[model samples]
Target chain A: MELFEEQGFEKTSAVQIAQRARVTTRTFFRYFPDKEEVLLADADADAVKETLVQHLLQKPDVTDTLQAVTRTLADFDWEKLGPRQILRQRDAMIASDPRLLERELIKQQQLTDALRDVLCRRGTAPDIAELAANTGSQVFRTAYRKWLEDNNDGDLTTITENVMSLLAAIMARGPVPATAARLP
Target chain B: MELFEEQGFEKTSAVQIAQRARVTTRTFFRYFPDKEEVLLADADADAVKETLVQHLLQKPDVTDTLQAVTRTLADFDWEKLGPRQILRQRDAMIASDPRLLERELIKQQQLTDALRDVLCRRGTAPDIAELAANTGSQVFRTAYRKWLEDNNDGDLTTITENVMSLLAAIMARGPVPATAARLP
Candidate 1:
């Protein structure tokens, strides 16, 4: 991460990273399949997903799957992942490189799919489950970004609730009366 | 796409694809930087994004940005992209390959960012723009998947409307009354 931040992700090599860490290239490869994974690696992503899914599954009432999904995520101890500054740098690094960005997105999509499946298993309608899972992820993403950007460690739950309310507000405004006529 | 479907994406080579197309590898590279692009390429995605942004800009009312974003997408002549079966097959192919799936997601995120930027340019609050763009995109994605699966080529507009209403319903249901107690 230090090398990537200093010289850019594309220019940095796995061998160089290995050298910096005083390890064999083979050992580095064992830990990360590629240089992109070096920064994006979350050995615990699957575990985190499972923990969140289990949390959602245990909810006494998941009739409101959007709220259920959002709370499941927003309520997690994100600080346990790392300090806010480190996570922010990692995010910026991913954002700066399209390859890393794509990998990050696939990881996100996988998490969303897992949440949707959990919702389906909990008896939510498939369509509603899909919308709730995807929308909730988006809401949390916005809140997470805001939390990272805050100089003071922001309360993620409050940020998440505010983001959710923003979504609700936009949907509540409803469509313009004339837009229907504009459809082809 | 035919080659990929027949032999799988990873198993196929650019040389083989070029051979099948009766073109030199040079010619193939001239058109697509890689085999992944062969199936995932949207030569017109940028143009489409620009067109959608322009439509949103021209909206008589931009206050309802979510509706504006979704309607712009739902109203487009998606049929012009290709037949339903071809599009479905392409979608399936992308889904089966993590590499292609990641690329597709990046493309989707880029479109969402473009829409969000347009909304911001139109004076919507930044947070609201992010939520509306991302949420609206999610709604349309579910609707689109449904549209592709329908044998009769279901109406995109109606499907998009239904999906949007599902989101509205979930949000309107409000959070589960007791979930707050569960939050740490």
Candidate 2:
């Protein structure tokens, strides 16, 4: 993150990064094939999928299945890292370039797909599974955004609950139907 | 799409594309900075938002607002590109690599944000706006997937309606609260 901020991600050389960390270029190469890998180091879509699936399997009810998945996600702790390091790395990666952003977005999509698969396995109607996964992901995202803003205060579980409630209200209200006459 | 399929996006030289398309490289550059641009083209986020806003303003009731937005979205017709070309391009882009897939996700995210903004502008609560937009996008995506599979026969309006009904049912059978039970 420091290197990326000092000199652009495109400009920062692997050799320079190794030198700064007092490691050999060979050692750096062993850890990451390219500099971009450093930004994408936290890519763990499979692990998340596994966690969600395990939780879903334990719950038979469809709604319980979703709640279990949400609960599992809320339990994740990205706090082991020093707060300063986490913020710096996040900012550097997202603000650096389009490529990094694209990679991050792809990882998120993979996570969403995994969630959808879990829903399907739980016997949700195919279309319902797709909608549930998509809706669940959006709620998770909103909760994450809130958590990031004030990580010191609210728990992820609480924020997620609020998001879920809000989603329920919106669903109850529902979108306007097409058969309803259109306004001029 | 043909250029990308015939020659890899990276390997296909700009000069070759211009020659094959019977246009100067300058003209190609004017339209797209790179070959990747051809696959990434879609409805402008701002235009879609503007259209939704216009639709919302026409509606007298909050219930009609989302329906209006769905109607506007359904009415959109991609300029003269046959169904086959659309399907091929969509499949090729997503299948080619993760990068393109990421861009597609980001594009969808942008659309969601625009929809949320439009909803908020039309007097919906902030949380409701966000939830509505997320749900609406999910509906649109489900409908689109079905439409694509069925050779794009169904209108977006019908797809949106199906999705909305699904969401309503899910909420009617609301899941147990996540906070109801504490971790043992």
Candidate 3:
């Protein structure tokens, strides 16, 4: 991240990165195939995806697709994904560059696809599965963003639960209406 | 689109496209800078953004943010964005490939950002604006997919309205409950 911030991603090479970390170039290559991978690295999406799929496939009784999806998602231990501070830095770097941001969106879409696939396999209605998967990811994103802002030690699971509870309340209340006619 | 379908997008050359259309290379370049632009050629996102921003700024009292957003969105004539058949083809080409899919996601994010900006400018809470913008875009997407699958002459506006109405009813009912033991 420091290298990226200082010299931009395109200018930084693997050898420089390896030397900065006091690791051999061969060691760096063994860990990361390319310079881009150093920033894009994260196995968390697959981890969360496998967990959600297993949970849904094992217990089809969770008829409420949204609840089941949310439960599975909220239970994820984010630590297994990566270090909290590094993950945050990775997100920040991704946001700072359009190409990286596109990669992030691609990752998000992958998660959505995983959720959608599991929902469909559980015999959830196609349309409902689409909505549930989308909503689950949306809630997860909202919670993740909040978690990043709150504190370094913030618990993502608790934050996710809060996000879902808030969403339920908001939907129940519906959109707030204006007092009078106001469109031009 | 026929050219793209015949030969993959990457394989098709601007000169060949120009020759097929009986236009000079200069004419082709004048219209599109590259081959990819043939698919992502529309400025539809900006046009809708402008309309929504103008409507929101002029009539802040139109309370119900989703309602207002959808109404403004529905008012757009699909023809203005591009020919119906061509738009469908463009969407198909985008969906057929992962790189194009990423571009589509980036476009969707751009629209969301525009909606978020206008909503925040109108004094809506930032977080609420983010959620509303995402929901509005999701509804737009659902309507678009249905329109593509339905009759060729279907009106996008009507489809959008139906989507929004369906969403309202679904939200009112909430998610279905599980029939068996819930997740631990």
Model number with the top lDDT = 1
lDDT, candidate 2, A1-184, per-residue tens: 3477778788899897667655689866765567776744543445656666676666556554445456656766645423534544463545345545565667666777776777787776667667667767777777776676753667878888788876664444445343422111
Q: By descending DockQ, how would the candidates be arranged?
A: 1, 2, 3
Candidate 1 residue pairs that clash: none
Candidate 2 residues lying further than 4 Å off, grouped into runs, are A1-46, A57-65, A80-97, A175-184, B1-71, B78-85, B88-92, B176-184
lDDT (Cα, tens digit) per residue for candidate 3, span A58-93: 764656666666667766666565667656655665
Lowest lDDT block of 10, candidate 3 chain A: A175-184
Tens digit of per-residue lDDT, candidate 1, span A1-184: 5578779888999998777656689866765567776665556677788889899989998997888999999999987866787677667756866756876898899999999999999998887888889999998999899899988777998888878776766776785232221111
lDDT of 3 by residue, B1-184 (tens): 3467779778889897767655688866765667776744534556666776786667646345666556566666666666676567667756655655776788778877787788788887776666667776777777777777665577777777666555544443444322311111
Task: Rank the models by TM-score, top first.
Answer: 1, 3, 2
Candidate with the greatest TM-score versus the true structure: 1
Fraction of true interface contacts that also occur in model 2: 0.28
Error of 2 at B14 (Å): 8.0
- Model 1 lDDT per residue over B34-96, tens place: 877675545666777788888888888879888988998899877666667766766775686
lDDT of 2 by residue, B1-184 (tens): 4466667677778787667666678866765667665644543445655665676556666654344445555555533333544554554545444544665767676776776777777787676677667656766766666666655455656666766666555544556343422211
- Each predicted model: what fraction of the native A–B Cα contacts (within 8 Å) does it retain? 0.54, 0.28, 0.10
